[model samples]
Target: MTLLSDQMPCRYVPILAIRPAEMKALEELPEVDKDSMLPLILIRPWLSANTLSKSINRFKEAYGETRPWLADIDPFYAAALANDDDDDDEADPKKVFSEIEALQDPANGYSNWCAFIEADPRAIPCLRLDPNNINALTQEIITFSAMQRGICLRIPRAGFGGIGQIADILNAQNVTSVLFILDFEQATMNELSNAAAAIGLINTIKGKIPGAEIAISATTFPDSFNGLKEQAIAERGFFSLIKAQLGQFRLIYSDRGSARAEKRTGGGGLPPPRVDYPSFKNWYFFKPEKIPTYQAAAKAAMTHKSWEPKMKIWGTQMIERTAKGDPYAIVSPVRSTATRINLHLHHQLYFDDPPLALQEIEDDWVD
Candidate 1:
């Protein structure tokens, strides 16, 4: 199910976000039907505004005629779940709710509702999760609500866009959208090959989800190494293996440098001599598009899900990489020449012994 296997190239070109009547075009898509779909129903859990039945009815009415994607797609709303002041701007409590209201028209039926029931009873999920719960669900009525609607779930972040938590949330909230994250192409030092391979792995994850978009740029950085290489042969070897095994891939260099670098020069305490590792600026993506092999690699990405995808990596740094996969900067005298490679591997561990109960998404919403 990679984006492009000889048999699995994606027919879907770009990812689209719809609201209200904008969904009309989706209705005509053959994939809308349950029988034709690999998976039916597109969950817009992020749409928390239309929580009230009246608003939801309007939301449905807005897109009632044209959209087939969410025919019965019910969103997961957590008004009781308060957010922190530092939360993403797009995720502002009031904005999330108001947008839902904007979609309301009072014509169609509610998308279905789920009241949050917490374990502590008094410590309701909404009360703890959403800061604007009162303002959002202020007039929510109890009696007319239906259990068939849902239990309004919470998807905890995992540093990397909350992968796999979507399904977990659905199970908790009794909803159906299997939203999850599949990170592909998180740039590593001297790991272009592995980055490419990671994209393939991501494609594989996406292939499993009918309407999923890959969760991209979740952990990407500002290219801390500035296109630096590694000194360890073992690390490069591992990257090779990763590249070979990747199912789908897309990458953007990031700056998650919690690691330090030192030179073995005359000045032991001082920073090492200048190294000339190639840079792969992601400012202008799509070199992969020009190369048939790279294009194939992109198509080979076995993506099964989709998240807000982007190129957090810059576009100017990368030059024609060597066969060995080292990114060479396209510049005179190599900006940081004679630079010996030292790679610091960053890992995303789900279980790291001490036991973790909470997760947080780190990136800011672009819009």
Candidate 2:
């Protein structure tokens, strides 16, 4: 696929903690976090305006590449550091370059830590205790928050506190529905604890925002998950993790090709890994080879002792079923609130079924 397609990098889906609707809204805003945007600009020096072209050109001439970070000077810093002279002219690109150069130059003893201090000295051990520094840092954060209005919310993998921060913002924004995607490629206790806590926070806020729904989509690996077997094992782990934490689905929709999002390309640098997933198209979302695994996982997740009559319809069906095949089933959680998170684990394959063709299967089918 293309290095960067029109599609949002798939890797970010789980990071943003957004739902389908919110994801659509984000596509309109096309929010890019400062962290992600900065790196992209830094690596692709040509993205910078012509004013800084000279500095970029010079850097390219010297280092055989344009310094992407130097391309578009941070408007925040440019305005912060601008001269107050009555004559209004663009900030001197050369001076701007020099400051950034100084900030980056290790020869000047400006290590990353020093840059951090320079950017927000309040974070320093000594300064952190100072009220003035704290005030300044708070203001900086607030200002940064305002700047993020149009950007996608970039959720950090930091523990509970970080997740809490995300919760507060989403709640304030009246974002009720969320999809938390867990990338367990590199699992750890701390990470797991933080994730669980994050879910708890989401649950806590559900009372404030009525109709709030949160679902988790997790991927995991087993001792041996290579080639064809990989799909089944991954789904097993995905279901098991969610089941271990939350429990069974309230209702489930099992179709092979429904949610097999496009594979992602690893991120180039600091931003979360870039992904290349398919957009909303009528066609199957997953690959054709993985149908059996998806069916197996769905069967496992939706298994009930006996087909309860209530298991039939969870909510308004999103798609309609036809004689050709069953429509994808809708999966529901035991509880609607965040307290009982729902997990949708299935094999990764593209097994397209007719709209709303889901049939009630015996519990033994899943067992």
Candidate 3:
């Protein structure tokens, strides 16, 4: 049954990693169980560490007191929990054996947990017919491990006095997932201090969120395009060097671009003078030619199911040409199996201004 309307905007970005807990949460919803079902059980093939970590947290919170049986919650969680309680960081041989034995016990009910597992995230399931798993990241794939204990990290705009706090949150014994929002508002291109700060922040957070991937969202860059570019290059370098990192990176620009005084065409019956230098381009808005390399770099920061990687770049759709007939810095995704599927689904959903058949979601999971 389609509990969520196809017409409804998905609360989360479907392209990014979906946590098993998020999926499990859907199954446990009141709508799914008319008969007061105990914890819902799902049987599936593969569960990514990202999915398992988030699922554990979701169930941990949603089923507080009335803890439902998450047969499929990460097998390691029980051990991790037990280990967290131990004062010494070193593993005790007997303690390890006890946890393993407890899990093996039928009374403990930690075996063959079920959640409807269809697609394997690791397999980089092809979206449709494109034959390439282009949408999957090639680097650290963000998962729930970054936000263990349901902790969320919001870096402050002020001097990062909160770095200690962020470390505290990331170091939480139960922390397995994190929603790391890198606030670059204070970033100034004139000085590398902000850039240095960002590098420091990322280095500190690395590998702190265990098992699951981290979700990175950057607010904005500097005032000048050069500053933005400098910061972007620096950040790209930092993540490239780090072996352990998050699953996804989202760049949300505060403004599209600062207005520029390109000489007006036909102003007072005068043609604009041709300029040698092209207009400025920033990370947020840039030439389409840059999309492939930029997206590739962004995806590089993520871990993917396949080495042959693809990515989806979303921004303002450009169709019209300006009076000068010069094209705007229009950005778009490259062709791939995933892109085809996205286009097919988009056409189906918004083919009409107000779609006629939105009441029922067409299963676009298949081509």
lDDT of 2 by residue, 59-112 (tens): 333223311121112222333344445453455444444454444333322243
Q: For each predicted model, how many residue pairs clash, with residues at least 3 apart or on different chains?
A: 73, 19, 29
Give a tens-digit lDDT track for model 1, residues 1-367: 1111121111111111233211322222222221111111222332345344443344344234222221122222222232334556566545445434333322222212222221112111111112223223322212112222112212223223432333332333333322222222233445333455445444544454443333222123223333332232222333335435553443211111111111112533522222222122211111223343322222222121211123121111121222123434322112222110101110111112112102222323220
Candidate RMSDs in Å, in order, are 18.5, 18.3, 21.7
Model 3 regions lying over 4 Å from their true place: 1-151, 169-173, 192-196, 206-319, 324-367
The candidate, 1 or 2, that scores higher on lDDT is: 2
Residue-wise lDDT of candidate 3 within 46-111, one digit each (tens)? 234323334434434433423222132222333355556666545543443343333333321212
Q: Candidate 1 — worst ten consecutive residues by lDDT sum?
A: 338-347
By descending TM-score, how would the candidates be arranged? 2, 3, 1
Model 3 scores a TM of: 0.27
Per-model CA lDDT versus the true structure: 0.25, 0.27, 0.27
Q: How accurate is candidate 3 locally (lDDT)?
A: 0.27
TM-scores vs. true structure, each candidate: 0.24, 0.27, 0.27
Residue 46 error, candidate 3, Å: 41
Report how far off residue 231 is in candidate 3 (Å).
Answer: 12
Name the lDDT value of residue 276 in candidate 2.
12
